[model samples]
Target: MLFSTIVATSRAVGTTRSRRTKVEELRSLLAVLEPVEVEPAVSWLAGEPRQGRIGVGWRTLAGARVDPADAPSLTVSDVDRAFTELAGLAGTGSTGRRRELLATLLGAATTAEQEFLVRLLTGDLRQGALEGVMTDAVAATAGLPAETVRRAFMLSGQLSVTAAAALTGGADALTAFRLEVGRPIRPMLASPAPSLADAYSRFGGDVSVEYKLDGARIQVHRHDETVRVFTRTLREITGSVPELVDLVAALPCTSVVLDGETLALDPAGRPRPFQETMSRFGAESAHDLLLHPYFFDCLHLDGVDLLDAPLAERLDALQRVAPEHRIPGVLQPDDAAAKAQFEAALAAGHEGVVVKDLTAPYAAGRRGRAWQKVKPEHTLDLVVLGAEWGYGRRTGYLSNLHLGARDPDGGEPIMVGKTFKGLTDALLQWQTEEFPRHERSRDAHAVYLRPELVVEIELDGVQVSPRYPGGVALRFARVVRYRPDKTAAEADTIDAVRALLPATDSG
Candidate 1:
């Protein structure tokens, strides 16, 4: 298929706010794609390339200027092949080689195609066509149930792969997707609760209150001698975390998939700062700060898949496979007992507790109310829209951060408020060095970003405001930390921010 078709469809999807219209447009596009072009086209529409990051950035793209072709002649395969070559470039002259290759690819495209390719390469493509919408489109085109496509995607952890299967082989191919012991599936997510009382009221006594640890999320898959560890985003990190691999390898079960948290612990067995734990994730080896794994949920054990099993049964399997490493929690606890567990988790240097419904099956990659996380203080993972230059001793650094909440309706992030509090000198320096890479536009007071970075912000509450488009502003907002594990799409939504409004002033 021609690349221009994709550019036109993306533009059509972006210009409309109706999700049904977006899905219909994507369905029309998917229904006509050639079999060989399915995966790459789907990946591009999802804002991720099939080749992953090709070492291209905004600076490199800016320098690769070339005259555009008058007509659309480039095929989807053409861009894929060029990106493959670019991703393989290395050594001293690789930078120049990448620029040359990108220029060659862009020079053969028209203006519209050039815009799409640049956005795709630089990770700045923010149209309404998200993975969920594309999944719905795929299901619609294939004449299969939406849940089937979603299940396959959750198990495969790649929408591109699942979409290809659905488009090519229909229902039978999607059914072929299963909980493979070696392949890492998407991790289940939890929604935030107002308080412990609210969680108890929702689930009654049929809930398991588990400690919500302050650490990086890890998913370990062990099949016999081989053990692979993946981060929450399903990126493999087996080599960086040997301790995690070895720990899972020693489990009595021959094959298992464990979902849990891993963090560095001080001498007193208390969890270290989140940054210290995350720093080890990018290292070649488990540096001096060795991470310890704590297993909480079991997705697979032996030969049986527990993904469809209730939390009660999954916990039983987790106990059977790695009882010693299970997280601290109480099953079916009374209100007083659940409260005590929540306090105990906080006292033990953990974040808080997640109250999970005992009867609900594991909903991978879906953040639902079946599991609700309760913390003592209100915290939100918000997008960094822009940052202002610092003053006083912090001069020359990006200080005040303009925060935004993710739009649930697939639009631009909604601006909530700004803050300069809780930023240490080290954080300020890091912001100055890092924020420019995501720059969209700039002015004398601030450098606006592409709404890509997710930062955890703590706020007392929110109040009605006309200063921002969201009609709400964060109260006493301050930076808790930058959540490298999360994507901008996974940040707390505008509805969540509005849910924090004062009771009498909810208007």
Candidate 2:
């Protein structure tokens, strides 16, 4: 099959919000894709390219090389060779070479193929269809049930592995499989629930709620005395957190697979700023940075596989094998008690809580009602500093808005973040018209607005950053609504910002 055909199908899949439509499009494309072309198609749709910067003042860059003549000769083996070569270049050489290589490869493709390739390389293919959608597509193409494909993916971390299984062994083979160690499985995630009460109602009874810390998710695999840790994206970081490896090595079990969040905490036992924890992992002397791992689930224990086990059983095994300091108990209770516990967790400075059904098995890579996160409604007061032109559906509107907090001692506002989230089409139109009235200047793609609008913003949490002028940036920040009642001078200040900062070890 031609690359353009795959690109066309991907475009059709992305444009339609309906899962059925996506599945159908993928199935039609898969039917014509020769086995020899499958790997290349997958690589072009999922691979990440090398990136970096030349100097402090230079913009970060991506690498790709495309020769039009090479497009006809492209094969699955060639794609595999390119990805292997690109991965090898990730940590070496000037950033320019990598960017050039990537540009060359992508430039070789036709326009539609280039669009698909760009989205895949940038990791921002907002089609709401990733591995899950692919699973459905594979199942539809192979004449198997979606559940069968899902199970195969759960056991084998690779989508290609699942595809091969569906194409050869058929659906029955998927159901008979078990997961192996040393090989990673996609991590299960919580689905959004309407409300805490609603989540509790759905679970009926016998559920566990755990504090959802504002930290990075990790999977720790231990064999005898050796342990390895990986992030949600499956990047190895065992060397970055040597202390965590030591902690896992000390577990009583001979071999175990544990899942949890790793957060940096203060001597007072409160969670430290998220930036501190993230910085700890990337620091030159990671050991110098105090970090802690809180184990919450056990997927393997003492030569036995626990992936097929229920959550309650896994939690029990996790507590038995892991040390007390490292294993925090899940919050299990009745409806009223769970809500009270959630409120208590929030009051104690936790992000929120994740409620899990006791009997549900780990649904790797799947977001389902088996687990749900309950975070408090987010809101903040921010001053608008600028606006950027919108794209796609947001075209002709001031979609991206720059936000800042007041400077201490009354100086220029310090820009902390920018966001395009939480804007209705009507709101976008209003901002596009009103922002120019306060415009300080206009650029090719953005309008610099005067410090005039004060809006109520909301976010998950504040993270430490070197990028923002305030030395801090908001995580998942979005506009709650326009706070027209407040003037720019009345917007929140740096001292107020400092007050909102989570208590840290430095204090």
Candidate 3:
């Protein structure tokens, strides 16, 4: 099938917020596509040349040059080959050439198709139907149930693999599948709850609540002495975390798969500031820094897969095989108890705790009610320095706002961060109208506002950074509300800001 056909269906899918419409459009497109065309179509959608896990990609020039009469039968292997060639080209050539190549391939598509193709390629497809929706699509197209496709995905760790399996082997193939090592399965994620009470009411009294440390989520797979560590996204980083390898290799079990968080800890045993941990993780220095691996869940022990096991069972296995120091458990069931634990955690310089359900299995890649996290809100009084134009639904509004913090010695406020979050339509309109009144200068895209307005900004935590003028950046920062009563001069100072830094162990 022509790229244009795929593009058109993708565009139709992108234009609507409805999952049913998107699935229908994708199915219609899939009907006309030869199995061979699936790779290019998906490649064009995902934006990357197919990589190791996904099918292979082909050179656009070579692929487009193929005569329609001689076009080979499209198979999963062909897709894999194409992606391998694309990956090689991407590694050696200029970024512009790669982008140009991608654009040329996409240009072979229709305008509507081009829109969806671009959205997919750029990872900006916001239809709210991600993997789950894709699973539904695969199931619908293959005459299988969504659960069959989901199970296949859980085992194989690749959507396209599951899709192909369902299309070729049917539902029975999926149900009988088993997991293999060296292949990464998707990590499970937790959904949010409004409050602790709501979470408790759902799970009842027997649910487990574990301390949710602020750290990077990791999955460690060990077979005898060999160990591999992967991030939540399944990207391997075994070499970067040598200490973790030592710790995992030392575990009692001969073969195991464990889920946990890796945190940099100070001498006091408190978690280091997130910025410090990130910097340490990114450092090129061979010198080792102290890291704590807090094992919370076990998926595989010995040669047995525990993915189907209950959380309580997994916890028991985790305790049995993993080291005592690595296991993380602190029970807090009630609001008062949870709040007290939260305070103690903060006082001890640790991030808040994660409350989990003891009965839920590891729902790989699915963000369900299995786990819930609670962290103390970090709010700051910051001055608005400038505003930038918004896009799409937010077009014509002052959406991006530059924020700054007061200098300790009292001079110009240092630029700390920028945020487009927490704005209502009314607030946007007010800012658009009122900001120009305080305009100091103008660029082609943005208006520089006077550092006069002080707004209360909330964030997850502060990270030290070389990019910001303040030498720090806020993580997950958003607006709480405007602080109309506080002037910019009355904003918090650098010294006051430094005090909020996590305590560092000199040892």
Clash statistics: count for each candidate: 0, 18, 13
- Which candidate has the top score in lDDT? 1
Model 3 stretches with alpha carbons more than 4 Å out: 52-83, 90-129, 280-287, 331-340, 378-443, 446-507
For candidate 2, which ten residues in a row score worst on lDDT?
50-59
RMSD of each: 1.9, 12.9, 13.7
Cα lDDT of model 3 by residue, 1-507, tens digit? 554455456556545656687677666665555665554555444334345322222333323321132222333344345345546664455454555545544444444444443344333332222455566777888888887788778878766666666666688767766766656787777644445566666777456766667677788899978899887667677877888889888888899888888878888788876545555455544346767788888899999889989888888888899757454455435766666665676677765666778877888876566787555665677888898999999898888989887653324567878998998888899889988866767888898875667787877766677888667777788877675434564565544344445555111
Clashes of 2: 18
The best candidate by TM-score is 1
lDDT tens readout by residue for model 2, 1-507: 555666676666655545577667767777777775664554344332222111211122232434445344344455445555655564557466557656655666665555555555443332222455677778888889888788887777667667766765687767666766556677887754546887787888678888878777788888877788887656678888889888888878788888888888888888887667777656555766678888778999989998888999998887788757443334568777888878877877777888889999998876567987777864556888888999998888888989988653233577888999989888898998898767667889999876668787877767677898778887788887775434554566554445445668115
TM-score per model over all chains? 0.95, 0.68, 0.67
Candidate 1 pairs with clashing backbones: none
Which candidate, 1 or 2, has the higher lDDT?
1
Stretches of candidate 1 off by over 4 Å are: 90-97, 126-129, 503-507
